[model samples]
Every structure is written in C-alpha cells, then in structure tokens.
Target: MTKTVVMILFIAACVALGALSGAGNQPGEWYQSLNKPFFNPPSWIFAPVWTFLYILIGVALSATWYDENNGRRLVLFAIQAALNLLWSPVFFGLQSPALGLVVIIPLLVSILMFIAASWRENRAAAWLFLPYALWVAFATLLNLSIVLLN
Candidate 1:
C-alpha cells in the first residue's frame, strides 16, 4: 500500500476506536454522580481535546510506522493505545476510578517509552506525542483525584 493510504488507514483506525469506545462508555448518570475534583475540566472540553489528541497520535503513529526501526515504538504505541481504550471501559463502563488509575499509570509509562523510542527514528513523531503524554499525565492525576474523592 502507498504511504498516504497507510496514513489514512491509521487515522481512520484511531478515530474508529475512539468513537467505538466513547459510544460504548457514555458518561451518563453513573459518572454524573461521582464526586469530581475542583480542577476537573468541564465535560464539554473532553470531546474537542480528545479529538485533537487522537489526530495527533494517529499522525504520529503513521509517521513512525514507515520507519524501518519502528518495531519497538509501534509495539509501545499499540500497547498504550490498547490501554487507552481500556480506560474508558474500566472507569466508565465498570464505574471504577481506582481501576482507571491502575490502567492510566501504565498507559503514561508506555507513552513515554513510545516517545523515547520514536525520538531516535523520527523526531517529529516523538514531538507529536508530547501533548498526548501531557494529557495522559493530567488524566492520571484526574483519575487519582476521583478515586480519592469517592
């Protein structure tokens, strides 16, 4: 397949997975009842922020996928993405902030590893992941706060 085709596929894959996860785990009454932290962002912010991040991550992964040395980085990216997908189900579907924290911590670490591995092969790819890392870091804290408060 052509590089462009592969890139588009990656983008589609990320968006599809995100949409499916979001659909499966809608934040309804269970989430509304939880005691959120003072710093918790308004619910409206999540969609836009997540949309942007997922796009960045999709591009980053596409860039890294073409690199010959991307095996480990791609593996890390897949692991992190799987963990990312898992978080919504565990936290929202199952209604367990504590489990979310458990999943997110490793997700953050895998993201860091992915960034570090991608840096050597493609700096742009690594740079694309910075915001994702920061967001997950913030999310980890948010998940922690939720667990603590509730």
Candidate 2:
C-alpha cells in the first residue's frame, strides 16, 4: 500500500479505536454526581476534541511508521496509547478518579517521552504530539482535581 493509504488507515484506526473505547465507558450518573472543578468542560466538548487529537496522534504514528530506528519511539507510542485507552475504563467504568490519576500521569509522561523521542528525528511527529501532550496534561490536572474534590 501507498504511504498515504497507510496513513489514512492509521488515522481511521486511531479514531475508531478511540471511539470504541469511549463508547462502552461513558460517564453515567456516577460521573454526573461527582463534584467537578469549575473548569470542567461541558460533555459536548469531549468528542470533537478527542477526535482531533486522535487524528494528530495517528499522523504522528504514521510519520514514525517507516523509521528504521523507531524501537523506542514505537514503544513510547504504544505505552501512551494503551494508557489513553485504559483511562476511560478506570475512571468511568470503574468510577475511580483516583485510579484514573494513576493511569493519566504515566500517560502524560509517555506522551512527552514520545514527543521528545520524535523531536530530532521527525519534528512533524513531535509537533503533532504537542496538542496531545497539552490535552493529556489538562486531563491529568482535571483527573487530579476530581480526585481531590470527591
């Protein structure tokens, strides 16, 4: 397959997997009852924001896909992706914001590590992860706040 085709597939897969992960682990009454911070965004904001971020993440992954020396980068990407998918289950499915904090902190670190690893080799990939890093950082703070508030 062509590089463009592979990239498109990667993007689609990221979005699809993310959507699937979220679909089954929605924040129900338990989440609604929790005391959220003042800055918690409306529920409507999450879908679009996550979709955009996933596309960026997919692009970053595609950028590094063909790298000959991508072992470390790939590991970082996988670690972050796994942690990202794991958060919803821990936070919403299990209704444990404290456990979510545990997952998200490492997730944020893995994202930063991915960005740093990509910096010298593929600046585009690193730049792509910047938003993901920022969003996850915000999410980490949000998770921490939720844990503290409740």
Candidate 3:
C-alpha cells in the first residue's frame, strides 16, 4: 500500500511539474496573434491532451525509476523532463517560433533518448512514452511550419 502511494505521488509530481510549466507560460495574446498552420489544433485541445500526456509521462517515469539498472535511463528521463520544461517558455514566453524550434528539436531528441533508454529498463515505460514521442514529433512539425509561415 505504501509503495503504491509512493508511486502515485511520484507520478503526480511529474504531472504537476508539466502542468506548472504550462501554467507559467500561458498562450497569451502573443500566441494568439501568430499565424498558425491550418492543421493547428483548437486551443481547447491542448489542455486535455497535455494532461493525458503528462500522466503517461509520470507513469513511465515511475516505472523506469523502479526498474533495476535504471541509472542511465533516469538520466535520460531527467534530460527529457528538463527539455519538456523549457519548451513552453521558449516557444510561448519568449514568443519565438524559431527559438521554439531550437528547444523542441532537442526536446524531441531527449524524449527519443528517454524512450530508447526506457526500453532497456522497462518495456511498459517505453510504450508509455510512444504517444509523447508522437506528439512532440507532430509539435516539431507544427513549430517548423509556424517558423516558416510567420
């Protein structure tokens, strides 16, 4: 029971960190004024999608943390998390799609590295990160499109 609770809290912390990052860097008027691709999702879509993704990330992290031989994997997780934390600020806060691209490319790579590393520790962890990887890949494309358009 205690272990379960610890897991839950750990996961919650990861989710919370992502949420906090988003909250701190809101898509304000600066974001709204920018020209986006036609395929850009409605503003309403991001919250729920990120919420779900963060949960998956949290679970993946917990699984990786508990796995044996997870030292390198955990480092990957931390690197990815740092990259994740930087995206909103660079993209939204700084209001630079070009810079967003800079940050997200690395963020995407870190996520891939984390996913690949996770596979060595836990398959489920790797699986859990797939959606995140996909999302970031799509986001990278979106960012690229924006940089080109605007």
Candidates in descending lDDT order: 2, 1, 3
State the lDDT of candidate 1 residue by residue for 44-136, as single tens digits.
Answer: 989888888888889998899888867888889989999999999999999989988999999999999998888778999999999999999
TM-score of each: 0.96, 0.99, 0.95
* Per-residue lDDT value at 110 in model 3: 86
lDDT of 1: 0.91
Q: Which parts of model 3 have CA positions greater than 4 angstroms off? A: none
Please write out the lDDT profile of model 2 over residues 1-150, one tens digit for every residue.
Answer: 999999999999999999999999999999999999999999999999999999999999999998879999999999999999999999999999999999999999999999999999999999999999999999999999999999
Model 2 residue 129 lDDT? 98
The RMSD (Cα, Å) of candidate 3 is 1.3
Clash pairs for candidate 2: none
Per-residue lDDT of candidate 3, residues 35-60 (tens digit): 88999999898888998998888888
- Candidate 2: regions farther than 4 A off: none
Clashes of each: 0, 0, 0
Relative to the true structure, candidate 1 has a C-alpha RMSD (angstroms) of 0.9
Q: List the lowest-lDDT window of 10 residues for candidate 3.
A: 1-10
RMSD of each: 0.9, 0.5, 1.3
